[model samples]
Target chain A: MISLTRASRWYGQVIGINDVTCTIQAGLTALLGPNGAGKSTFMKLVTGQLRPTTGDVRVFNQRPFANTHVFRRIGYCPEIEALYDDMTGRSFVTMLAAMAGIARAKRAERVDEVLGMVSMSHAADRRIGGYSKGMRQRIKIAQALVHDPEIIILDEPLNGLDPVGRKEMTALFLRLATENRCVLVSSHILYEVEQMTRQIILMDRGRLRAMGDVYQIRALIDAHPHRVSITTSRARDLARRLLEFPYILSATLDSADARQVTIETRSPDAFYDDLPRIVLADGYRVEELDSPDNNLEAVFRYLVKG
Target chain B: MVDLYLLRNALRDLASAKRLVVAAILIMGPAFIALAIRLGMGSQFDGVLTYGTLAALLVFGFVLPILAVVFGTGAVSQELEQRTMVYLLTRPVPRWRILLAKYVAAWIVISATGLLAALALAAVTYQPTPGSGRTALNRRSIVNPRKFLAQLQTPDSPVVDYVTQRLSAETLEQLSRWDPDTPAPRPLLRMVLTDLNKLIAADRRLYDPADFPEINVPDDARQLMAERPRGAANARLNRWLLEAAFPDLIRTNRTTGNKLYRDVLVLPVGAAAYGAFFLLLATILPRALITGLFLAFGWESWVPMMPGNFRLLSVMTYLRALAPHARPQTASTDMMQIFQALSPDTVPSALAWIVLAATTMAALALALAIFSYREYVPRDDAT
Candidate 1:
């Protein structure tokens, strides 16, 4: 587990993460928040790149700054694309392995293994200078895993990857956690991160905003009345039907369009999962069905505001 | 093992820098011969080292040091500037090993080049006969002796004719009436050719303006002639006079001791300068700008800030003072006065050695520190 206790970081007059405290457990955990949410700052603190201005940051029960041994077990992929551009992917990974003092004969084998794991084996001979953004991202992962590190921390791993690349990378991440390694992936895309891992640690404005399972957090947001607007042939009938349900907190019909209606409900799960079944049984003709809760970005915006 | 790893990483890429290696060889090889030949001229006239040893010392001492500077600085600074050094730094190995390996490799290459140049120079300039006589001074012949004599006769030629009549046959013979001295003369006179041979020759001699006329030259022109040697003189004339004075002028060939002394004096200074430069480049070069700048110009201003510590001005000041007094050691009691007047404290040999050792160690240490600082660290921003 990685923990930061009452940790605060200040660069002169500017404050980064302030009075933030949390512990991250094993398994695939996503660090979720909007931009400037202390997500990257907290990662850097845990990785020993920066020291906390107050309190403590500990990984595997020790300070990480200048602690080479800790890094041996921790595979960290930074946000910046800072790989040596001249070296070929295989050579670059092999060089890091050699630095770790691995036997010369074992280095090539390790490079191949990591390349395969990241599905970069075919491009291993190519210089990193020629790599696309997504290819560079995979190569970074390959280097991080060259030593077969236990705890992997990847910050903004999907920043420059296309949708297909993102899906493939997300799947690879899922496979990584299955090996019993604790993987913490940080991102501002709530739904994208939600797809990667349900276990999460959430922060906002340099403070811990929420933590625990993805569904539990979603349930908390769902418990707060969710707003939905619908347009259909019988909007008054739909509003009347939604008002009768215990989950619906409020409902209203548009004055100009008899087919349009707006409704607020405490449980999106009840309205979404069962509303269609209820409408079908009544033989109601619904032209449109949409919910603002389809993405968690809306939910985070509402929670933070409240 | 880790040191070896770092060293390998740092050195592996540069091993293929053929241009740098070739440049080092070219510089050191020819420089040996030039140095030896220059110094050989000095001692050859005054019993200095044979042309052979001068040749050898020039190559071994001077050429070697310069080669070391080029090679040593090239090892670290060139790689860093090229940005290719990042490959080695990303490795897990420590920095010190990388620096030491590079320094040792460059030093070996330069020293080897120096040795090669020295050996080549020694073989080429080596003379089998060490006791060869002094080189002859050449002279030109006056082809029209009678015409020259008529030309020399004064406008009062009748008076000269009367004096010539009064003179006896033996006196006339001694006076050389055929080649008389004249103040004004006619143009188309036939003259007999005659040669006046050279009187003396001495190599390795730093001729003084005061002693030039001792060789049968005009007394008044001694100082004027001292400044320019063989101005507008042709090679044939030089050879004829050298042949004429071959026997009498042979005694003054320079001894071996003078040549050795000169070589020895320049050897250490040249080596020390080169070593200092390389050591500086090897160490924290970026930081070296700070200390080197101070050493170059800042020390003087900084020293007076502390009233008692004025050794800041010692290096250049000592060199300038010693330059004018470059004579061989003469035990004048005034020497003590000269030393006392300059400074109460005398510079000790042991102190100089300590300072050199400290400077070298600091340079190497700084190199190791900078090199190591770059190694085994992730520069990536992702984590």
Candidate 2:
């Protein structure tokens, strides 16, 4: 497990990661935060690349910096564009494996396995300079796994991948987590993190504002009234049908158009699951349905305010 | 044996820098040969190109310092810049082993290539022919009036003779065609001495069967005389010329003898000087500035003579003092003036280099330590 206790890091006059104390359990934990929210800095601290100005960050109960023994269990994917462009992917990964003290006989096999895992097997013979951004990201992931690390912490691993690559990576993360190892992945995109793992730790301006599964964060957002809008040919019929529902506290006709209706609901999940059925039963033709205030952004806005 | 691994890696990269390796060989080899040929042709047709000018040309001017800078830093800087060092340091190897391995590999390659170039230069310039041989042949002979007289009017000599009645009418008539501002030729006494040297070929039929094959040339004779027993009379008129012309050349040969024990053994005391400069630059300059400085001064300033502003002048003097073995001092003011001018600025240059080397090793150590502590997975955005 990885734990940060009152951990804070400051650079001369600027705060990097502020007073973050949290336990990351064994599983796929998505570290979700916007840019400059201290996600990468926090990852660096946990991985021993940067030291905290105050407090403590420990992985397996040891200081990460200069602690070679702890590295046997942890893997870190840094957020820098640093690589040996001259080295072929296979040779580079093999070298890394050997450095990790893998037996000479197993080194080549381990390198090839990791290359295959990241779908870089065919291009493993080529120098990393020839790789595209997505290919490079895959090779990076391959290196991290060459030693078969117990905990893999990837800092923004999906930044340059297309949708197909993202899906493949998301699947790869799920597979890695299923190996009964801890996987901590950080990203600024809420939707991206959400697709990878339900377990999340959220931050704002270097402070940890929330931590839990997606449902728990959704509950925090649910406590506030969620705005729901509906557009239909018979909008009046849908608005009148929805007025009796107690969960939706208020309703208003949109000013610019008579064909749309907006409702304020305390429980958006209930409104969403039931609205379609009611509309269908009432014989109303719903042209559009949207919950404008039901995403992680609204959740972050609410929690940051609180 | 990660030391072995480090050595292997360093050697691989150095071997792979094809253009640089070729450039080194091409520049040093031909330059040495050309210098030897020039020296061989100019009065001392000696086969050996062991000129102080040549040594200065190869070491300070072109080869020695460049090798040190290129191999010394290139041995490890490429890994650091590429961030490949992260892979090595993160492994279970000791930091000192890494340094030592790299040092050894760079030293071996630099020493080997440099010595080969020096030897090649020596072979091309050192003359072993009978007439143009390594010794001073002291027998006096009459010089042809016309040939000997022409030299006094040449660019190198300051003295001029304008007498018109001392020669045959044909000789005088030939001389009168010369410009008046130019000196009338005078016969220069060509003195020569002899010493042991290898002979690869000889043509007995070329000269008079009764005459000695050894030719008398003052500069070559003086050089041969310096290595002879003290009781021998120097046959050359220009002992001062020989002394002035050959110190830097002799130092290159002298320094190679010192290489078996020292770390940077390119020039006699020059490795220490250049290394000191590089160490200082590495220390005070930022990462970007280091590359800029190396490209600017390192490549552009391939001068044969040592610059006046070089750092480590004192250390070079100390090295010069401590070289081979201590000897009684010779008090030639001209030599002293040259040495004094070449001496580096002691306080700042020495202190700066010491700090620079120390700090570079320290920074490298810290980087290694940091790398060892974690496994680096490539970042998504970094791609």
Candidate 3:
């Protein structure tokens, strides 16, 4: 739904987004990065707020800058918490709906529907200035969704949300994706992004580091050592047996608890497959097995650090 | 449709802003001062008119422009400062529409406030008293030629020769028919005398008999020879002087009042142009308020005092060009003389409005273009 070709944006001497190229399709895709990692810059570029200093950015095969037709199809929720404090949430959303070319007769209905989707209908009559942080975030999301655009781009939508609000928002994003809408949400929060979708575009220092499903990204970096912990009473025995596997780089008994063992493996898949077999053959009691590098955090760490 | 929506939103926001209250207060300051001066000093309608003109210069010229800067510069800058500009910019509406809508919103507020103040000042300062003969006469006569002539005479016996040389044949015949012994003057003579008096008074020194040596006489005669007789010719000459002066008086009063009226009418237009100018400045300069203040108060006020067409750069010149020509007496007033350098020729009302309209359109267009092309990054609000 959105594409960038060698797109770069520079703010005088400061680089906002470098010469990075990527395409995003319809789905709930998380843009993962650390602070100042050009995630917001990428969002702005795709949303057509900032033109790339070089190359091009296109949405639906059209340049989005001042393109009203393309803009009608795209909804952007900026990261800044700037809102008209004097206006009620409903009015704010309705105003945006009107600007989006929603029929005047239907704007109220559209505003209500979007506000309900974000679970902000109950407090929609209240001025945004008096709203809680989570409520403000919800209202911001409501405005972005008010027009029912094909592409919805949110930057740090989960920044000020409570845990329940986050859960609701994640579900809303999932629902949007299910509706065939392209949802690209940018965030530095790993767990929230993981909860939303495995499809992600990771960035760092104004450069795209990796893009794809979290596991696929993780799999690509399997050459990096993986750390696994085994909470078993027979720590020394497990450690000694683990050394027998050629894929296991090293193993050691936990310092605080002799019952626990930690192992580094060059191949985590081979280590897991051999673990149950050895336990069954030796009749050894296996309490628990946990791979710390199994999730997106480990994947992000590897990609960003490497 | 989008422009309408944006304009509606901008107007709503302006109505809710606390700064608008301050702007209204600033706009009314001149009216209040005029009221105070009118009531405290028991001044006449003419005094009120003069006060209104002075108010236009100080209030509309200086204060209203500052108000425009305050409202206009903040129209966009406030949104950017608060980081709320994204909401407006991200909408499907065209960028120019957003800018134009905002500019119109600010202009409406400023113009409405300024015009209200102007109307109030005009109403307060123009309370005509009921049928006072002296006031009527004051309005009818351009100059009291009798009083002017008396002021010009000294203890010199040559006054009759001077009067004979200056007066026209017709006026002299009329004067002679009433009292030929007093050396009657005609219309041309009266005009020459008036012109000479103007030249002599231009320097504002006392009239000296030494200036005219051809009409030699004794120094004991402190008054004109014509004053010694109470004759029909004297009365006829006085009647002729009135005839000569009335049309000019009526013309001066009408033209001056019309000019004042025009200035009042164009205050709103000037306010809108200033607002747009400030808004344009705000787009590229971070310290737009400082620049607006410097331009409105420092540059606009000071530049018009400068000689040559260089004053054309100031917006005040255009506004002053809409003012009426100053009457000689009023022009000679101490306060009016202080601002004499700043006064401009009275352009036609239509031409003045056109200049104001063109200025406003140009400023708004520049502001719209700047906003459309520029990329705005969210800045720290605390800074």
Candidate 4:
């Protein structure tokens, strides 16, 4: 329900987002990036908080920059931690709900309903200044949801949540997505988003790097030669034998470890499947096996570098 | 709904205990001074003169402007400083409506503080005027004879001419030796009053009421008794008749404290003008508070006394027009009063009202327009 056409923003000479085009539909979609990867800038554009310096941003086919119609349809949870410290969570939610044009008859009910949704009902009447980071996160999300907008953009919403809170929030996002609402969540961490959705738009250095299913992106990362390290008394023998497999691209012995052999292969599944057979046949003792490619950081490294 | 919430939040801030304490402190400043004056100079108290000068110099010129700058400008800057603006701006309400709502709150605060300060000054200094003892007279109410005494000390005052021909050379020397710059002791002023009173009463005998058939000698007697007529009487009989009117006129009275109400009433208008201008400045400029202080204290302090119609440019000028103060006999050399004390000008109250209203509306409209179009996204260091 949101689209960006060659959207780019700059702060003086520093680039925030550069020449990025993307469309977000009604479902769960994670914006994945490292810090300074323009994810927040992209979120601000979609949420109508800012206009792109040289591009078009549309929400529901209308430009979203300071447009009330788009604003009424979109909810935003910003990454900024500052909140109205003196106000109660309920008061904060009620104020925003009122501004969101919720009728007075339903404003209080909606504020309460959203506070419950974020599991903030118990402490809703307490001043937000006394709230912990997790409570503050929940309240921010509560305010965003209080308006009942069709599209919700959350920037680093999971940053301060504990494991259970994170899990609950992920489940909440999953439920919202199932209801056919557009939920665009941005984060620098991969595993946090991995729990919520398979679809992700990866960005790095102000440019869109990849966009698709999480596994597909992983597969794209895997297409490059993957490294698997093995430790054994006969490391040189295993290196010599591992080359017989057609999928194994190369094998090199670790210079510091006499018993370790590192193998490179484009087909990780095939190499893994054949390694046990090769070791069983050769009767070479294998003590340990490890793959650096299992990590998303390593995946980003391989993809972003390429 | 948006307007209600915005206004409520702004009012809530004003209702805080900290603000209450600040209000108490500001109002006490004028109260204590009035008390000290009333106690120090008991029977000789002149509330009109005191309230007139202090209200104009302190309340209208200083307190109102400072309060407007802090509260009015803080309506926007405080929100931006705390980064709470993002929440307000990102809502479904139009930007201008939000700013207008907040401005209303600031205006109320500024007007209320100014009103309370004036009320405090008026309450402590309230006294029945010494002459009529009923109606509170303004700067024009020459309740005190010192003003006339000061008038008589002038180089070619007609009353001085009238007195010179009658008094001994030694008494004339006392009148001459009494410097107008440094106010003469109270006894010396009374001595001048007694002489003038005696001479004018004696002069009235020169023309019997029956002799002047056209003059309404009984009813117009008090009216003529009120002021020193600046010699419109060149004819010998007219001069004698003019001198005849001085008996009741020279029976000088001190000003009552109740006269401060007009000065008090003019403060809200001043608040609106100052509040709107500074509110606009805060929205447009980054360092608006400092600029506002300079303008309020530095620019407004002197523009009203800039030798000509230049007072037309200052908000203080219109306020002064709406609530004019009686100039004190003693010359005040402070920067706030230096120019205003030296240069006295008359402004039509109607013109002051129209200009103030127009300036306030124009500033508010510009502030609303700027707030609507400008991007005030509080910078997030994270991104």
Better of 2 and 4 by TM-score: 4
> Per-residue CA lDDT of candidate 4, range B163-202, in tens?
4456445556676777777755566655554454444444
Ranked by lDDT from best down, the candidates are: 4, 3, 2, 1
Q: Write the per-residue lDDT of candidate 4 for residues A15-48, one digit (tens) a residue.
A: 8889989899989999988999989889888877
Cα error, residue A238 of model 3, in Å, equals 4.8
Q: What lDDT does each candidate get?
A: 0.56, 0.57, 0.71, 0.75
Worst 10 residues of 1 chain B by lDDT: B319-328
| Highest DockQ against the true fold, candidate | 4
> Which of 1 and 2 is ahead in TM-score?
2
Residue ranges of candidate 2 with Cα displaced over 4 Å: A12-15, A221-294, A300-306, B1-3, B11-53, B60-62, B75-105, B129-285, B288-336, B340-383
lDDT of 2 by residue, B1-383 (tens): 44565677767666656636664674467455666466656873423323333544343345655665666555556655555555555444544455556656655665566556655555455543332312232222112333433432232321112212323455545545655455433322221111101000111111121132122112222222333323222222123222122222111112222222331242433443444334334323325335634643544342211455443322332222222111112344454335433432223334434643554465445434433333332232121
Give the least accurate 10-residue stretch of model 3 chain B, judged by summed lDDT: B217-226
Q: Tell me the lDDT of candidate 2.
A: 0.57
How does chain B score by TM in each prediction?
A: 0.40, 0.47, 0.67, 0.69
Against the true structure, candidate 1 has what lDDT? 0.56
DockQ of 1: 0.12
lDDT of 3 at A68: 81
Give, for candidate 1 chain A, the lowest lDDT window spanning 10 residues: A63-72
For candidate 2, give the lDDT of residue A213. 73
